[model samples]
Target: MTTPLPQKSFHDVRQALLARQEIALVDVREEDPFAQAHPLFAANFSAGRIEIEAWNRIPRRDTAIVVLDNGEGLAEPAARTLQNLGYTDVALLAGGLQGWIDAGGEIFKDVNVPSKAFGELVESQRHTPSLSAEEVKALIDQKADVVVLDARRFDEYQTMSIPTGISVPGAELVLRAQALAPNPQTRIIVNCAGRTRSIIGTQSLVNAGIPNPVSALRNGTIGWKLAGQVLDHGAERQGRALTEKTSADAARQARAVADRAGVQRAQPADLAAFQAEAGRTTYRFDVRTAEEFSAGHLPGFLNTPGGQLVQETDVSAPVRGARIVLADTDGDGGVRANMTASWLAQMGWDVWVLDGSPAADWSETGQPAAAVPPPEGHTEWISPAQLSTWLQGDTAAETVVLDMTTSVNYVKRHIPGAWYISRTDLADALAKVPKAQRYVLTCGSSLLARYAVADVARLTGAEVFVLKGGTAAWITEKLPLEHGETHLASPRTDRYRRPYEGTDSPREAMQGYLDWEFGLVDQLGRDGTHGFRVI
Candidate 1:
């Protein structure tokens, strides 16, 4: 028999937030559903993969955890899973999501609401300088002395960008802006897919005391599209490598900003002390480019480029109030770490930059710690060769392949006949599939599929098998793939399509996205639970 779990009232949760207490308000639903409606600080730990993601996200076994769902019946089971994983203070939100709503809590739509709301708050407090899309487009038409820089990732720049805009991702704005705009008179405009990165990036240059006039492109590409301005597709301009003097200058400015923001500096001994803190969660990240991190990084640090770290703080440090130690060894001291930590500090995080050299602990490559092994269970696995034979066999009609991948990846490519479905919706969607005697689960890699096998077997009462190595392995062996939206077993709400993410977003969606962002400040005002304090 199970013990009756404790319950947290919405008012109790609000008090915890007010006190800045260490608490994890977990939403145990699919990312899509979680994005549709959730409290301001809720961290999504999707129901299906709770076992894989819980340990790293909530490191302390005794941390206060309140799991919730919108009548989806996932919270109780998720709470039990947390208990099984040695979590001591796990409980369910009384009345789940609905209770929070009844208690006058505001519901926010979208993943990373905390980070996004903070961005709006930053703009409100700092009034970060920006240029209207029409003004930027006019400057481009006149071939004025301006350099437009895309602060998002390089791939994002490649999709759709302002005419002649060059890719100079996040922290690189400080490191490479001088080289890009040699003339001090050149006007600099920084942009991202949307508001967060643009605000943070443009403010970074201004905060760094760059001689060039700096401003973010208002509303980013979305604003440009709404202004009836044409965007350049397949733009290839990239920021050149930073020189030694540039690196040193950037380091000096970054350190000054970080110091102003009261970011702490931690040496190896300090880091050891942080790791020993009882009931405290600490995340170690290397804020450098993926290439640099891949070439060499500290033993235990995960790589999240400095720019993305600032733009997606909620994703990077989901355990709100966790201590974050950023490490960088770009041969220019801790410039990258300092710059990234400065924003995180301003965003109300307990962030620090690792000091001195990390040379001794450097590794040529690093992989994340392995996930806890799946519990003992009845699971079956099928090799790619066997799957191929089955696909060609007389019983092929009785077997169904469900590819549980992001909607974007599903549209890009998948097995020729596989149906796309959210792992969380497996039970409901199974009924929609053509009746089958056998089911094979697959994803980009087989990690998620492995987790889904047992539940699928019990739900459908069919022989369930995981496709070994998943779809990637099949493609490696010259198998055929079908692209486009052909076989969708469920609605494509598993992933939210950002207006600025891809090339061909509908214009109305772009306008809706901007409208949604414009209202965030008002929403944050109503929520009042976001303890965002901008420095």
Candidate 2:
């Protein structure tokens, strides 16, 4: 028999981790068990995903790796596979997690790995308190004294959010919280889907020792959905309304706090002059509601909204020490924008806000004319004669077809051999597309196809062409259309089930979620009247 592999002691692994050694901890349990609980920072490289997403997800081949499973079922095989893939340092976690646990090591729980641990910290500190869906509805019914602050990314909030919640992302909480909740008596609640930032945000206020009692909207919009609550999706300006406790009052308090914090705002001309200055990197943001933003706003402006801009500034603008300019449509936007600017100033960024309305609305005052309506949809029908000619000619090896329509539509039907990539995943997908390829973009509607062309041109600087009227026009004109799965693979359909939250069966995930909510309700009861309840 071959000699047994060297086994590392628990202390050795822990020491290696503390010293920041090049180590990849792999939990080899089935996806469900692994997802429920594992060592913090452990990457999931299941047998299936390893073959497909491994190269993309984990690019380093020289990093040391340690694999573990419930017993030893998958550890050896996974280690061998990584070794075969040119991983220089790969080994099995001797005794696996059981040995670590037996040695009294810690294990973390929750969905989405690292985010859950962060959320747990927020929850433990009471950093975020949230109302259940029922509680929000009841509050609405009772006309209670509370303000709802949505802490999700801007796009997600615009797509769907609690009816009354005003968008104020986590990073901006310290700056904008006072504006959303002025008095110590007026309650403030933060929300995000399934905790994380909502909890972290609520806690941030508490940690800063704000006078008001702040809580998280527990479980966020997802919990709201599971609670059988109705979400307001039709475009409406619910954020414009002010309760008896308003953001205006909060703004006054925030301005006072800003004075104490030594924060400043910039006038429109000052901002314009700054933009004109050379060798300076600046990101201008319009922090208005999506509807107001899409209707008409500044040129070359991204509609981040107040809440999400605060939460995802790092992803939105990764460069440090860059100047930031914010624009708001009304009191809500203005207060939130100023609040975010204040924080960035404290964080060593040169931040400013426009003194007046966004540029798109300045047309009435003889500013550049109002934004022109985007062009109507087009249908570029390639004649049958033209198609024959192109087919006869040599096909470019560096050609790619991007289908930017909805996933559901792509599944139902699409052009033959076209790569299906949703708009949401465009930024990431573009990075993987070979620069050598001449991309041809298409979508269900010609409008989206044109938008894809523009995006490709802006992002890649590569030659791109649209399919004229998109796949719809192609089919309508009796042109050939391809069907069935093409280059795309199906997403993982295996659902995770939690026994602690409910049963081990897949059907019990929802029930388990409900059970967790009930537990939260009980905890809230003992914790006193933070003004939240579960339905």
Candidate 3:
């Protein structure tokens, strides 16, 4: 039997925060439930993802970590997982989320509370200029000399965006703004799905000393919707990659801003030394466009767009005291890295920008290949055609099919009698499934399903098979599909339902989201645990 784990009262955690010490208040729930309500400093280290993300997120083995969930029975298991992974200090919140509330701790809605709160702090301190939805709409209606820049990922901009807004993303804002609005007289407005990126993007240009007048589209796309303004759907106006001269200029400017923000520069040797440190967690990321990163990137470096990194710091790096290294190879200069490092520095991170010279030496291109292979003597793939034949056979009732796609996607479409199960809970969920001679697994793509073949086999000792090419391939072959949630072996808590993601979210939820953000400062004041320092 597992030993009883240590526990921390909310007050103890609060005191630790007040002391300005490093503490990772982790919520072990999935992104969806964690986003609904959590402490301001809580980092979501989802239960199913602990093994993959724990090392990078919590670098120091001895750093204090407190895990919690709303009585979902996930915190204990998460704590045990950390202990097994060589984490020296791990504990659970005494009463989970409710304990914090009973202790008068503030609860925040949404993800990336640290970054979002810091953005609010930046706005309050710098008074970042902004225009309401009505004002911006009028400017477009009158054909004013203005350019609206969507400071969000291209896919988000494609989903729904302000009319005439160009997809500039986050870190790309400073690099491409001058070219997009060459005339100094032309006013520039930056926007995102919500307030953080819009505020940060606008402030970034102002901090870099751009020539044009910059303002955030107040409250972002959420504000636009609340104002009853129509948004453009499937818009594809994206900023082009920076030119040679433009990249050099951007590098110089970004380096200067980083210096002002007290961000350090890391050489290849310095990075090696950082990794060699005995008890520190270090994350190395290439803060460039996905395409640029895919074309070529440093070994051991993950790609995270600069703007999104700042917007989702908690999600990207959960350990508050861990070191972070940012890199970019744009025209022989790490411009995006420097710019991204500046914001992270201001937000109280020990961040560094890497030199761009070494990036050219790596000849390898495309995503890094996975290291794990299928277990020996367990290689079997069932084509959609074969699966269809089985479904119509005499033993059809004995062949069990499990769909591992997202809860939302599973609800939208699945095989007629396929049972929806969480990949993390597959072993336990098998007890609920009727005994079958064989089990078949499938997802949106077969990649994840293939990875699960060994696990399913180990848990049940049955004939397990992977659906070739997944559900997408089945549709290509004109296979019939059933819609809606017909069968579910588990609760639909694996994915978070974002108000900004779907088209049919209520206006009240959108306004409530804005209202929650507006109150973050006050909540931070009450918590007194957020160790944020705006530069």
Best by TM-score: 1
Residue 353 lDDT, candidate 1, scale 0-100: 90
Q: Evaluate model 2: give its lDDT.
A: 0.56
Which residue pairs show collisions in model 3? 32-496, 59-281
* TM-score on alpha carbons, each prediction: 0.95, 0.47, 0.90
* RMSD over all Cα atoms, model 2: 13.1
Residue 39 CA error for candidate 3 (Å)? 1.6
Model 1 clash number: 0
RMSD of each: 2.0, 13.1, 3.2
Cα lDDT tens digits for candidate 1, 1-535: 9788899999988888777677889998877788888998888887767777787677778889999999988899889988989999988999999999998898998777776777778888889999999898889889999999999899889888888899988977888898788789999999987888888888888888988999899999988887888888889999866777777888899889899988998888988888888978888988888888888888767889998888776666766767889998848757778888888887777888988755767775845555575744766888888888888899899888999877788899998789998776677777788877899999987777787877778888888888988989888978888999998887886666566677678988888877787789999889776766666
Superposed model 2: Cα runs more than 4 Å off: 1-150, 153-188, 196-213, 219-237, 243-247, 257-262, 294-296, 329-333, 343-348, 356-361, 364-409, 412-466, 469-535
What stretches of model 1 exceed 4 Å from their correct place? 364-366
Q: After superposition, how far is residue 210 of candidate 2 from its true place, in Å?
A: 9.5
